[model samples]
Target: MAKAIGRGRGPTIIDVARVAGVSKMTVSRVINNEAGVRDGTRKAVLAAIRTLNYEPNIAARTLVTAGEARVGVVYSNPSAAFMSDFLIGVFEEAAAKGVRLTLVKGEDGLAPPEAELRRMAQGVDGVVLAPPLGELPAIRQVLSDAHLPTAVVAVGQPTGEGISVRIDDWQASHDMARHLLSLGHRRIGFIAGNPDQSSSALRLEGCRAAVDATPGAELIIAQGAFSYTSGLRAAEWLLDEACPPTAIFASNDDMAAAAVSVAHRRHLDVPRDLTVVGFDDTTVATTLWPPLTTIRQPVRQMAATALELLMGAIRNGAPAAGDHLLSHALVERQSTAPPNRARAPAPALS
Candidate 1:
């Protein structure tokens, strides 16, 4: 019922500046992530914003600055656990950087509508693509064609020209295979991911290299769609074979956990007649009673580094310097052991 001018419907930076006793420009600088704002000034502006619950008009600011303070994050992964964890990491960093993050949800996270993806970048300053399969062919065209900056996170290989954040997946997977081989597991089995995925190929390469390196280790292979039930189906097929592998490595925790279920149904004692392992230290690994052995991917670090790198490129128009690769560690748990001598040798399959 009062006038609309003084105590308006929404709070503004002018009110925040008035509360902080600073110029509107100073408030703008602090909100826009300018480097010149002193720590004291920044603190005061932030306090004023909090006190007033002031929200900036991002659309209006973009019109003035000619760009949006948003960084797009593109992710492609089937596991809900993986997606959620990675997003949490990304959002945490974005909040610290004062950049609004825009997510362009591609169809089922597949590479499509490169043009639309690029247009999605029209207002935003930069982007980060997560993982091997996340970088669809369309992604490259959009970023390259527009000369927009980008950072690829958790990618196995450097994109050759842009900033990237990742771990040595080959080394991590190779180490997991070694863990099984060290446990005196000779006849191991593999549940591979979809052939279309590059991570699937790299991960398998790691398994092959590890087994081939061992003096007397053997592996039988089966392919699946990277789903838990897919892992179950493949594990069921391999476990029923006359020569069941003593140990199995699923490309991810989802599948590896499935293998555990299959083993339990067959009344085979885990780590006795059968053993299982998974990559990516996801929550699924710990959901099992005995847990799983896997590689602890630096998910949070990767996401943060990607944000840092993308911010760098957005400000500089060129990719950031040096390597952004992180390291991985093997998380050993109760799911593996040497083959049980009492168990029947794999019977020859018909």
Candidate 2:
């Protein structure tokens, strides 16, 4: 008698073959999307697979005899709501690939990183990192030391500075600036993100390039710590400047929301009186009174592709290297416009 594979333990190819009255080779072909199997046989095999809740082992050899394979995702956040989308993106892809996402959240609080990494590394076949937080050299080194296939989904730049999956942040910001400039705005305010992150530095560089490209346009730059409070302070400084910018661009949605708040308190109408824009199309973009026009980060698609890349690496029977850059789109919401009704340029003091 064949030993039963317990529920939630994952069904093997042999289990599918036995239940469907077919050979293991046929099951393999069907799972890989190969076209040789008979349609009727394929349906039977699929039905049996569904009956047993069968999920093919995406890690290949690691599935059969060894312990359960884990895919570690190192994220940085103080709370879950901060990364609700990230967690959803990661786990949904993991489930489709029949791999588990072993999450490790690190920042100021939570568990000791080294100890946590060690614990999370247990039975892990690959690693996925979500950053500005995860793009650290030390973090990649830890994954390298484990010799696991790894992918980094960056929050900032798409330099692939390290092994990562990112969109071109510099180009994205540059495009954002150009959009505002096309609307006939001359003086533009730019708020940067965390200083330590490569992404933040890259975005600032993009803004500078845009300013350099637009003749007669002045760049009003302020550094923010990538938080709502930091965003408010930075926007306040820019707004306080004499002959303040007509348009404001924030590096992320959180800061952008803060900027809108400042504009509101000053009784400035968005788009008509002052144009505001933000990066990363988070829920906050739509939730704001005037929905933000921002860059759409392909987070969920990146997450899915990361899983596919990791699985491919695992099947190759070696550790993974390098990075992947996904495409990004501009989601134009209601937050941005030309400073058309510009009134006496609004006293910078206000």
Candidate 3:
């Protein structure tokens, strides 16, 4: 009998494989009673299991090996609040399914190098790609070549090659813009998110469509990188203009918070002199002096749904290709109100 190593937690499938002198896959096959193992190898694996006292969970037997099924999550987003919520959902589902997660951080919203991606593919059975990183064509091609199950979260549209989990960004933005219009905000400042993300363009288009449909409505666009600093700069630019907007709509909560800060610096009271709103409805939205009125994108739910899709594909031994559109809601709060008529910008000269 092989000596069992002492682990502080408990005996794992890896320990069983080590004692049996076989691969982890072989141990998994034995545990699940799958065919293709020689009688001698099977007996050796069973003996090792008995010696180590290993217990396999249902997820382990039905899906891939519990300890061996590695799923990679790649992200390069700059928003801490959004990432915090997303990671929570992922970890919860992964723990429940008895799966291991391998996190890979990309640089400046770009995917890792081809060589690094290839190396990662060898270790992971599937991958979950967060926004901006999933929009890259090279990254998609590389993963497709590897034949790994993949799930992309928060993209504007489904890529059709992998599982996509997201809210309808265009419609959500459109609804938010319409809400502002209904509040009598004719001239609204629009702060866009990162250009590299497909959601940015779709969101901008949605806001534009809403503005164009309403008579006398005008939109002043400013670029943002989905960071607090970028939001500050954009808000300052919009507020310093000859005819400043009465209301400002930022693509995310961080930018919206910056707009509120700029309003305060100018001695403007929120929803009195300036109406501000944002999207994503992250924690920052409510932590401000006046809670923000914005769109709830369900970030945590989207992450969990993506992980579930990836795991299902891994179990079925096929690529997961479908779009899962989650529901979004317009959350009303104290930050948005009817634009103060006295503070409205002067009409442009004909």
Write candidate 1's Cα lDDT for 284-332 as tens digits. Answer: 8898857888888878778888887777554432334345768888998
lDDT of 3 by residue, 1-350 (tens): 56546767777665675576544455677778866677777898799888877897665475434445778888877788888888988999898888789988777676888888878865676789988778899988877665566899999977787889999999999999999999889999999999878899989999999999999999999999999999999998898878899999999999999999888877788988899999998999989979999999999899999999887655533336899999999999999889888775332232
lDDT computed for candidate 3: 0.83
lDDT of 2 by residue, 97-180 (tens): 677667787774233378678666544657777765565666666655544556767656444433467789899888888898
Q: Note the residue pairs that clash in candidate 2.
A: 131-155, 157-199
Model 1 ranges off by over 4 Å: 1-68, 107-109, 320-323, 344-350
What TM-score does structure 2 among the candidates reach?
A: 0.76
- Write the number of the candidate with greater lDDT, choosing between 2 and 3: 3
Question: Where in model 2 is the C-alpha error above 4 Å?
Answer: 1-62, 65-68, 78-82, 108-112, 155-163, 344-350
Model 2 RMSD, rounded to 1 decimal: 10.0
RMSD of each: 10.4, 10.0, 8.8
Clashing pairs in 3: none
| Per-model TM values vs. the true structure | 0.76, 0.76, 0.80
Q: Where does candidate 2 have its weakest 10-residue lDDT segment?
A: 59-68
What ordering of candidates by lDDT runs from best to worst? 3, 1, 2
Angstrom error of the Cα, residue 175, model 1: value is 1.2
